[model samples]
Target chain A: MSNPESFRELCRKEIHTGPTSGVLPGYIQANLLILPKCVAESFEDLCTRNPVACPILSKTEGRPQFLRNHASLIKQGTFDIRTDFPRYNVYSRGKLVQQKNNCVNEWSSDHVGFLIGCSFTFEHALEKAGLVPKNVLYNKNVSMFRTTKFLDSAGIFHQCPYVVSMRPYKLTEVEIVREITRKFKKTHGEPLDWGYDGAKRLGI
Target chain B: MSNPESFRELCRKEIHTGPTSGVLPGYIQANLLILPKCVAESFEDLCTRNPVACPILSKTEGRPQFLRNHASLIKQGTFDIRTDFPRYNVYSRGKLVQQKNNCVNEWSSDHVGFLIGCSFTFEHALEKAGLVPKNVLYNKNVSMFRTTKFLDSAGIFHQCPYVVSMRPYKLTEVEIVREITRKFKKTHGEPLDWGYDGAKRLGI
Candidate 1:
């Protein structure tokens, strides 16, 4: 097992370049949101209204500092918002602007970063329950689909579609899966729906 | 009870100009954070790491749109972030820059806003449990103290002090207060500590 601190050091050194899935088994993983201050309020509203899709874990204060002693893995080190991530999907005016390894030059005094809880937190519980998450089994990213369900609008995020990441399981495993995932409230707790009908209900 | 939507309408029209404390009983009220995009990521990280002190309710989506049908009070209407609040405290480089009733001219697309949950959500529960929050009893804003406890740093927000809003309660009521407040996880959740020693432990 990689020492979480060492893993972070590698990320900081630009040596690790890949998805963070299953990297550090027990530690929590997060999705990231970086945006300008001008539209951050609306994004906050969206996360508030849509907790399932946007379970926020933490955010930075208005100034930059090295994160120290929040979670066990994020211990006593500074991470560059620009170059730390393996990849970043940049958005501009609600459109995918570009993909980059670092955004150091783009960062400024007015930017904000949000670390949202990803579905990975609960996958451990699912594995513990003896139900393997499909993505882990297949070595593929989880399937995500946009839904017809309208997310609550806040500021600039108006009536946007809710997105769902899917993992397949047998009919027999539904009960155990729900029961296990429900405990992870800070993550995307509980499945919204299941089966082929589930996709249809979401109007995928 | 006042119609929540109407109350918001007045605020939108610049007709209501006062603290929203106890305005709409039983409904949630939030503290507002509006900052330039340059520093928003750091602020977001701060909120995420220190949820107890800075429980975030929602954020803007980085665009301007009328918030429609999220919460009952925030029904179909456009809110001018720059002019809607009774007042706004402007911060520059982490310093209190200015306070304004309207920031219309200063607002730009590069700014983001955050609506953080205030302690009011649990106050009603406290009242119902026969333990009145001191702020409510005294008709004052809750007493807030800055603690020596350092908040977990995210991005640019490093080594910031944790700020806590205090509500004094009788020693006999500590258990009940903790029980009642614990249910409101989206807000500031349960009491961190109780009594004078609580402040001392927090290094006030």
Candidate 2:
């Protein structure tokens, strides 16, 4: 059970009870968004448009208990969208309504799930390169701000404010950070804004 | 105005009416599929699963005149899902009903468009790498075969045979070809199989 796959098995068995972060280092972890099949495409469009905030790793419909969705990528198994994770926040009608350790009852046959990427993946690369971000140095959560920027609306999805994640680096280190992170486009590649002038550009 | 963008401008105005191949050598060309919003997610899932046959570059809904999606990528303008392409084959009720240079009348606000990648993009990469495909050497169309393999079915998109496009190379050259093309994952990313055994494996 030392490997991430075995760790996922523990998660499936409800034995490993904690957040998935840092458990699966060097492997891409995902932020999950499950929705009814009816609005799946529209929300996918929103995520595609706002990739920095919602870079999609994989998406599928009706396949419960699975994440990476190609038939080639997955074996017949349990990814139970409901029980695979340690915990879940249930949203209804665009609002967070409840929290649960297991969401098996919340899932339906027509549900679609998106596995999105975040800064977590590339932050490892940053750490390996010795460009530890100020957030980590200070032991603080990455600063996140909702920019006035909005994603283009898709069907039934409108006015999505593009959220930005901020981690400060020395101005001298910005170029190297960009060089390291841009290669991982799936994980929000390169900062959207940085330094004083870059901050001004995003109007942060 | 000699670049691909200007070429697309010509396409938008209907001044260019020919197959969009080799015109923009360094730029990515796409195969377009548009469907009503109702079944878009199902089809997208199918494509995502069968990426070698249908590598998606971008997809969008509602923005009728676009190809590369995302609010960041597009300005309000005309790629005219219909008029931007040099030609189109219109399918109706599961049959190819008509071929036209202009499909404007066929589009509606509810339509979703997917821009899929093909061997076209990486073929350029191969040519640049000095490993001209046998198809190009013989000046013939790339050989395409419908394998018994089927794409993982999605809603309303079922029983789809996974198509394979074959372009031969010397056995010794296969690895180099693979190395060159694999980086371009958007464009099918390397050969599915290679050499005589590879051919036999496909039962072609």
Candidate 3:
């Protein structure tokens, strides 16, 4: 059996400090979103309203152990959610700035953790099906872009251009690609649009 | 906390003699196919080749533990491969005849168990995502039809039009339906084609 503790230890010591893509294999990986509890209910409502941007795998209130499904592997150390990730960008007034580990000390009890499904989960499923992922092989984060489309909004999470992660493949493999995409709704399942080129006006 | 043993007990007592559809929630229920050892390798090969059709969840040499993933559950009794399922049909010369349970005792030792992913997996996911499953609500088996598309074959599993199981929805819900379909690849991911009235072609 794959050891979850060792996996978490690798992350804790900064040993497995790379992007958590393709790490846990069949185990689900999730996106991290922390916000004050005042905004938590609103964000949860937002996710329910616009599931594409925020597919809630689990949510943590006051404590982080609520992510038991994914956090089951974090053996010895408590998940210092702020630092365990390879890198973190803090947003203040919607402006992102880099932050170091242990930012949890700054966290108040009013904070809530939203464990959203990430592309990593579906990407792993694709590789298991023998479909190669060019972005992962190239060792680059997926090509993410802010789109002109609007996502359903609730409270603080307002309607904005949907952000998308893209991967390119040959036309021959389109069937298999589409097949894999169909199974991962929580991870932004199917492409919003295919064969989109950079030169086309995005209308953003 | 669901019990796999309860399912075994039902099979043993002949109390639950029906398709094991939506029986156990949150557990991975599988499609069972047993083949002789001589043809097992080829069938396994076929499963790998056409993964969308035959996602081999767990293949046992001779009816190994079906609930290997659930260690905590109590195992009540042995699962008689020849009789455990609610119904059995025997194939001779590539033609299947409905048979009572245990008719295949003579062919038992020569058989190997192949558990493939079933649409039940994705149906669970869809229900979790709050998507309505029209077939379930209407009390019907999912609509299945033979497609003109050929699946990659192995040995006796010859090239034939893929048999796909489908559920329908209005045109307006297509995108949301596709999104839910993307998350469950083991369950035949997505539709190969849509809006084609397959039932009429099948003379159903």
Candidate 4:
């Protein structure tokens, strides 16, 4: 494993395990997608088609190296796909397999990397606005739901519902929430709709 | 009059005579507001209170000089307050008197310069996302209408209706438009309503 002091201390030994939020402050955080190069191009096209759902930050054409914007987050050559992330889920034919923290041995030559814009940037903006993120406050993952809304799909892009992340806010702050989400298109732009009904419809 | 060559040329010769759009492209463009210092604190408070309507970009606490953000566009310590703009309207006690180009000498030391966020940023983001900004292409100002919605007001804010800017697109882009608008709380975030009849009630 590539030896970066922080990585070695926190993740390499399997001690630090959680969603990679609040890990590196002030730097852009990202969502990861690993796919075969054959399917990567089509997926990228789909992202372009429905950018609100898939704001593309950066992508690796052939191998799953960190994209340029995310390069600063790489600790060392130690990006042991298997052990680097606190946790990862393996997928076969679009079906998720056993969850693992590291996948060095499973790493394949044909893998390509896609990094997407995350809510971190907008969340930072929100914090600056003094609207504390309740999920972060409560130390829980922002609730995510699968929506019946279909993202524009391309070749081999399954016509499946989109997965959305949501948070609750006061009725008075609905306008504020609407305003903040407009800025970060790379993140899902805004809620598909408001209220628990919207959540239930999305199968949250 | 900081004597930056480019800004100097634009200001001195009045070459920068336009709506001030796309100038100093990456620099933040501010919507200019000049209010008497006597009313400044209350107005500032109003901005603070109704952040969506008035995103406080930068303010001159007492006088309009040393104005923030768009300073790069000023020339030789001079910004042509009157002739530099494409158009201008004079309002006394919130009443319109004349529409002219510049209001240079008419400005008083008591006049405080307020720069709030404009719709340009969100429009740029929308265009970047392959969504269209029809108003720009039509070469007209984005439609500004009054809304029945009363913005939460402070001193001079007075619970007045809001002035909303609209850029029309196909009905299909409703979701995309909503999403894009949400990001721009510093500006007006989303449309008060998607359609016009409702927006027209306030004499927009």
Which candidate gets the maximum DockQ versus the true structure? Answer: 4
Q: Specify the poorest-scoring 10-residue window by lDDT in model 2 chain A.
A: A147-156
**Candidate 4 lDDT over residue span A1-204, tens digit each:** 223446535775788777754445444556777787788876876665445567788875344545556567765564544465677778997699878766666778788767787775566667677776787777676777776444433445645466777777887886687677655555654445557654554445
Global CA lDDT of candidate 4, please? Answer: 0.62
Which residue pairs collide in model 3, if any? A182-B181, A182-B182, A183-B182, A183-B183, A183-B184, A184-B182, A184-B183
Ranking by TM-score: 1, 2, 3, 4
Model 3, B68: alpha-carbon shift in Å?
32
Writing each residue's lDDT as its tens digit, candidate 3 over A122-152 gives: 8877887788688778777777888644443
Candidate 2 structure quality by residue, lDDT tens digits, B129-180: 8987777665566788875444433445655655788877788987788678
DockQ of each: 0.02, 0.02, 0.02, 0.03
Question: Candidate 2: fnat, from 0 to 1?
Answer: 0.00
Q: Per-residue CA lDDT of candidate 4, range B1-204, in tens?
A: 333345535644656555543344333456877777888876776565445567788865444445556466444345443344455578977799886656676787768777788877676777677875876566556667765444433444454656677777777887677666665656655544455643344335
Question: At residue A157, what lDDT does model 1 achieve?
Answer: 65
Q: Write the per-residue lDDT of candidate 2 for residues A1-204, one digit (tens) a residue.
A: 566557667877878766553455577777778888888976875565445557788876456755554556654673566777766889987799998777788888888878888687777788889977666666556778876444433445655555777887778987788778766667776665566755554446
Q: List candidate 4 segments past 4 Å from native.
A: A1-9, A66-82, A196-204, B1-204
- 1 against 4, candidate with superior lDDT: 1
By TM-score, the better pick of 1 and 3 is 1
